[model samples]
Target: MRRSEEQFRILVQGVTDYAIYMLDTSGHVSSWNIGAERIKGYKQHEIIGQHFSRFYTEEDLNEGLPDIALATAFRTGRYEKEGWRVRKDGTRFWANVIIDAVRNDDGELIGFAKVTRDVTERMNAQKELAKAREALFQSQKMEAIGQLTGGVAHDFNNLLMAVLGSLELLRKRISADPRALDLLDNAVEAAQRGSSLTQRMLAFARRQDLDLQTVDLPGLVDNVADLLERSIGPAITIDMRFPARLPNVTADPNQLELALLNLAVNARDAMPNGGKIVISAREATVAGGDPDMAAGRYACLSISDEGEGMDKETLDRAIEPFYTTKGVGKGTGLGLPMVHGIMKQSGGQLVLRSEPQKGTTAELWLPVAQEQEITAPVRAMEVQATPEKRALKVLAVDDDALVLMNTVAMLEELGHEVIEASSGQDALGLLEQNPDIDLVVTDQAMPRMTGTQLLGHIKERSPSLPVILVTGYSELPKDFSKVPLLSKPFMLSQLSKKLAEALSSAAAAPDEDAAEAPAS
Candidate 1:
């Protein structure tokens, strides 16, 4: 029996993975095993006779938890807990600790036997796993939202195209009666608003098809200044500052313009009493970028207003889609989020700075282009009545009956002879038989044959003939942008503009592979 007891003592002293020690009745360390010395970062001589509370954190000691732990063990015979414990070196560990009351055979309390095991690795693993799960869930949710918004926006655009085109044509035909024209104009305006909403929806989902072009910063800013001031009202003065030279940016200028307009309107609304808005542009380069942008050289366009700003919570969620603070029907809650999505889609960033009572400043960072040759965009003409309307034979093709009829009506209203087809195959057949057809305007998403495929065949047969593809979807397959494009939900004025561009391309030397497309 004595030999077995000796072996037991050696076994207890040999272990080094845990801290095994004995505390006196007063909660002072009385004995320390080899494991206790190894795990607590202390020598047996250094730790023995010290208070057991020395192994507890400063916070735990202040709360008298060390004394309570001993009292509980003496009363209940055992105490067990998992928490952060301190080592002699002042480092912390997630420890699984247990203390048992030790008593003599006579049932009198003698001391306490304490055991501690480090569990930091296991705790860290659990936390990391939870974090990963949360990230995955967030990603899946955003993807689902993207798919839903993208599909709804596509269908909505197709309908808007039909509505907008018909309204524009109707407004022109009923011009004599002022009362009738005013009512028609109202309907047209409402339809245009709907079209704008659909575009914002697509923008929020990051599914708005982009028509990227190299644009000069100063020129673009100067061009939009008049429209910007007119929209913001007379109370708010506009200030513009730009350097003589700035790098051009690659972006969809129309979309960027709309985004800036949205910001301006937001600023106007914030300052009911009126305030000055500053529009500034300069060169910028960022390295190891923040969460919203990549590292690149950019043309920084900033819009600032001295008006009401946002608080922390509001600012944090400001860019979330459909989360507006404005009253119902007052705002769609999509302006900032759409701007955010556009900046990201364009490989740039949108940074908003605001304080509760101060004001707000929005910065649009657009990536710089490396190309030297800059092509000036064709200026859009706004003419209600053309002096000389082109009277040419045109082919209009679409899968949807309403949209096809709308296109045909607009062509007829413009005094062009309309040849209509409901499918790309039908349009192709018509083109082959009618060699004198001046232009072809077709829908993109047609069954069996797409607009691009038809354009491929048409180019092979008659490469020089002008053709325009109209669609709700802006994005197309690689190298499919050669034929001129007219975006869906367009007004008669837009239709007239694209038609003129196509008609003039016959005289000018165009890109050998691709035709210019409508940009937004």
Candidate 2:
């Protein structure tokens, strides 16, 4: 029975997953088991007499960890800890270790029993979980900011439109007095600047209308070469390695140029003392083999800077809205986020790679658009007259008093008779009174009834009446399939053009219009 008991103890000690061993009072390995061999990538012959400190990192060893463990075990009768430990192959692992002092009948220390378990996989999984949690938090915060920015941008655009529109009329009426013209010029410039700032906010919110087109990647880069050189001081060198032929990507040319400029400026900032920036372009195909990218032909544009790179934590949050490392007033923290939003809106992706000492690289992946589908020479707004006479009665609805008045004035200027409403409810009443109203232009967001709802009511009453929905908010309701939409703060010519097109289309499709009369 005694022999059998000893054999059973040995059998348990030989198990490979739980490393079992014995250490002397001085913390030197006295005996080793098969488990220790497997866990530490060692054999009994090699590690039986070695000091346990060999399993710890050099820093830990220098800190006298081996002696501390023995002292702790001696004082408390047992010691346990979990920390980084080295394996025989020079790899590090998370290890849970326990040491218990063993003594003889006389109460003299004999040895110590040690048990260790490899927990590296669990440690790594926990790290990954932490990263996922951080990413989720950032995404939620960005969504909240997006909603706030969108609303604020919408309101500001209405105000700017009113100011600019009134100015346009004033400019046309006033004589060319140098002083008056100069003052007007300044006001116009300020209003234009305000418009630009609002547009940037819209871009960050990903709500701006994109004039997407297929563009040659290299050509676009070349066009901005001079500007980039001027933007980044003469101390820094700008290098280009554009391929002879690159894939054409579908994107808004202006936005793409802005994105590139943002990236270049960021790169320049990183290199305060001046460094080289390499701009390169090439064609790439992401098949299933690449995990981060989708399967498609892509135009890859990369900007690399030999500057001070960001650490892991900073790089992770680099694209987040309002996250900037620069000093206050030095940065807005919206540039990279704007770039990210633009890429997402354009059906592309942006990725950043950086290391503490290895510098940084930003790559934009834009899916190649078909050559035939590419629009040539992007069109600007053109004023055209409608075939039908301007004698048609039009109803315009907007919550802003100034916007409504300005819109009415523009319509009257265009030789159309106009009826105005401060809200959707008022517009509905006017429409009910005059069923002969030829067109209904309504704002999307209003107090009582939304433009969408008002349009639905009107459609139900008269299917042939052309309805145009305008809003500073660009996103349309999902069900508004065939509805004509005009973005808010629009130029008078744009509004007139859109109104004409909607009316003409309605006139041509009388049969379909009657079938789907109600916009509900």
Candidate 3:
């Protein structure tokens, strides 16, 4: 019997995972096993006389949990729970613990037995799983929003094209009357602003085509300084600073300008009492270990505002779409989100720093590239070709009636033979029936068939027929070979430019691929 008791004691003392120990009736540790020492980071001598409460966190101890657990165990003969517990090194862990009342034959309590197991690893794994699930949900939500935004942009562009075309025609017809002309000009200006707003929405939705190229940061900031100053008014002072010979970055200059304008506007609003705005730029290196920045040289552009800054909670969610503190009708809550999308799409990073009562600073880190001077091509004076002599049989296709009529009017006004088709099928039939058709201009978004699909069909049959696909959404298949693109809401001059370019290319020797053309 004694040998068996000794063997059992040895088995209990050999454990190193669970913290198995004994506590006296007074709640002081009375005996310690090797498992207790290993799990709790304490030696037998050091912990034997210590109170069992030492294993609990301060918050638990303050709530008299040690005494309560002892009372529960003594009365009910057991206690079990899992929660955060402290170790000898002050590190906290999720721990599973159990206590049992020890007693004599008569059931009088003598002491208590305790066991604890650290479960921090399991807790961390669970947290990571939850985070991944949330991230997946957010990704799906953004994709849905993108689809919706693209559909709306397509419809909006059709309406805008009609409004813009009418305004352009009206300006010419009413130019003789100064009062009427002024009204037309104002309407045109408003329509242009609306076009810009639509583009901004596309930016936020990450659908806008980003024209990334080498850009001189110093020159860009200098050119925009006057505009920024005028826009913000004299009440707020504007300052510019740049390091000598800052490296050029790869970005879309126009989009960067818009982003800067957004930041300036936001800064101005933040400082309703008027304050200083500082625009600064420098070339810096992102270290390899940075989690958010790739290891490379970058042009760091920072905009600082001396205004009431955001608190921690606001700063945390500042980049979320449609989230804003601005009251209704004052903001669409897209400025920061759009800027953030721009940064990500540009292969860069955005850093925002703000503190309550202090000012805010927004930083854009654009990847730096090898120094390359960009030169613009000089155009020779064109012998003005009369549209009537250069006129070709043109096909204009669009689903919207008003837009199709506007396009026909514009084509006829340019002295070309206009053929109208409302569907891609109609366009194909027109091409089949009319062998004299010179060019095909088709809208991309349609009911049954898209312009790209129509382009493919036309190319298969008439290999050399020049096709121009018009779209507002700034994405297309990679294999859209040799086809030209024209953006919606185009004016006569813009249409003329695309047509002239396409006609010139079509007149060349048989080419298998359409020449890559820029959208106007």
- Give residue 57's error in model 2 in angstroms: 1.6
Q: Which stretches of candidate 3 lie over 4 Å from their true place?
A: 171-190, 235-247, 276-300, 311-313, 349-355, 370-389, 459-465, 507-520
Residue 387 displacement (Å), model 3: 7.9
lDDT (C-alpha, whole model) for all candidates: 0.84, 0.84, 0.83
Which candidate order results from sorting by TM-score in descending order? 2, 3, 1
Ranking according to lDDT, highest score first: 1, 2, 3
TM-score per candidate: 0.76, 0.85, 0.84
Q: Write the per-residue lDDT of candidate 1 for residues 131-242, one digit (tens) a residue.
A: 7897587657756776787778878888888888877777666758888888888888888888888788788778767767898877877888899999999999988888
- Backbone clash tally (model 3): 1
List candidate 1 stretches off by more than 4 Å.
Answer: 1-27, 31-129, 175-178, 209-254, 260-317, 351-368, 371-389, 506-520
Candidate 3, 335-407: lDDT as tens digits: 8877876887788977999998788999999999665765442222353433334788999999899999988
Q: Give the candidate number with the greatest TM-score.
A: 2
Q: What lDDT is obtained when candidate 3 is compared to the true structure?
A: 0.83
Instruction: Compose the digit string of candidate 2's lDDT tens values, residues 1-520.
Output: 9999899778966698989998887778888888888889888789878888899999889898878988899889999999999999999989999999899999899989999999999999999899789767776787778778878889998998788777877787899899999999899898887777677677778887776888877878888889989999898899899877676898888889999999999999999888999999888888875544568888889999988899999998888767899999898787888888788788788899999867899998898987724566444534354535566688989998989888888777667889999988898889879877889888888887888898888878887788888878666777985688877676667777887888877878877656889867
Worst lDDT window (10 residues) for model 3? 377-386
